[model samples]
Target: MRIVLDGISRQMVDRKVKAGQVLAVPGPSGRRIYPTFQFAADGSLLPGLPAVLAALPTRDPWAVLNFLVNPDARLGGRTAVDLLRDGRVDEVVRAARHLDDQGA
Candidate 1:
């Protein structure tokens, strides 16, 4: 699931919070959609999520979003967000490094 800037905050979006990962991607008819996982229930970016985003192999929004949602063997078959929620930032960083090294 995704959300537009209006669904979150225009100011945060404009500031390119968390390396701009929280910003929405333009879609058909000029729609913008940000990955839902990038935001928490309190409407703040999840802690340490940007670190993984920073270490991503690609800066493309879709790719980075997919990486966050997909399961990783290094994460013990858990998604990046799951690890982050569990306070396993080290593992997430390692997973990001592995992806960077593998050119994924």
Candidate 2:
């Protein structure tokens, strides 16, 4: 992640994670591992990711990650991350708001 972020300080990365601007899942050794899919090629957070994160019903990192990557019928069978990548932020946010409505 440091390499991908162009060597930004670890503190900065941690701050981003703490601020809910980035996604970091737990690694096997209990270290935070940032998922590359959450970042654009330029190492910035994917557009509208922060808003989607805020809209998600849960704050658990694993559940949030699963919601982002897993297929959802609410999204017409497309993953939230894919829709976000395609600039369909509103649709994803709407789906997220109703994640539990249909037991997603």
Candidate 3:
């Protein structure tokens, strides 16, 4: 099944992602955006995100936020859009394995 993300959610996810950022499936739809931190893994906002997000203003809406979103970016990582377009678990898994091998 495909996951749906709103514009704000898309923006947040996009910001969290970098061209070479480490990627881990975490699980199906782990890319979700939660409205509150209570539902997050640590019951706190994703590190180093709110500051930037706050500056942008919360005009967009998103859901099912994952805890894995990284703040310290390492540009050039895979993204949900990339994976969704690929449509191959093996390729994704292999790419992830490679990233793991690279110490992602």
Candidate 4:
């Protein structure tokens, strides 16, 4: 799921995106599409999410999104986002580094 930044608190979204704590992707129509995964049901950022984002292979939004949702062998066939929510930050970081090692 995705949300237009304006759908939420614009100021907070802008600040988070600027701080590299949130990912704002360019949508087909040239609007910013914020990934819904970045926010909890309560509209708060998931704990330790920014660190996971920082450890990702690339800053390209699509790449980041793919990484977050794709299942990984190292994660026992679970998506990185699942592991992150399960508090498996170190494992996620290692998996992310694996992507870098393969030059993804």
Candidate with maximal lDDT: 2
Query: Per-residue lDDT for 16 in model 3?
Result: 45
TM-score-wise, the better of 1 and 2 is 2
Query: What is the Cα-based TM-score of model 3?
Result: 0.23
The runs of at least 3 residues in candidate 4 whose Cα sits more than 4 Å from the true structure, single-residue gaps closed, are 1-8
* Candidate 2 CA-lDDT value: 0.85
**3-91, model 4: which lDDT tens digit per residue?**
54435678878888777789888888888887787677767776677887777768888887888888977788898889888888888
The clash count for each model shown is 0, 0, 13, 0
What is the overall TM-score of model 4 with all chains considered together? Answer: 0.80
Off by over 4 Å in 2: 1-3, 6-8
For each candidate in turn, the TM-score is: 0.76, 0.88, 0.23, 0.80
> Which 10 consecutive residues of model 3 have the lowest summed lDDT?
63-72
Error of 4 at 88 (Å): 1.3
Q: Which residue pairs collide in model 2, if any?
A: none
* Model 3 agreement with the true structure over 1-104: per-residue lDDT tens digits: 32222323645555544421212133446654333321224333333233323222222333112212322122235442233234433443333323324444
lDDT of 4 at 64: 77
Better of 2 and 4 by lDDT: 2
Tell me the lDDT of model 4 at 28.
Answer: 83
lDDT by residue (tens digit), candidate 2, 1-104: 25365457778888878888788999988888888888777777788998988888888999999999999888999999999999999999998887667565
lDDT of each: 0.72, 0.85, 0.32, 0.77
What order do candidates take by lDDT, descending?
2, 4, 1, 3
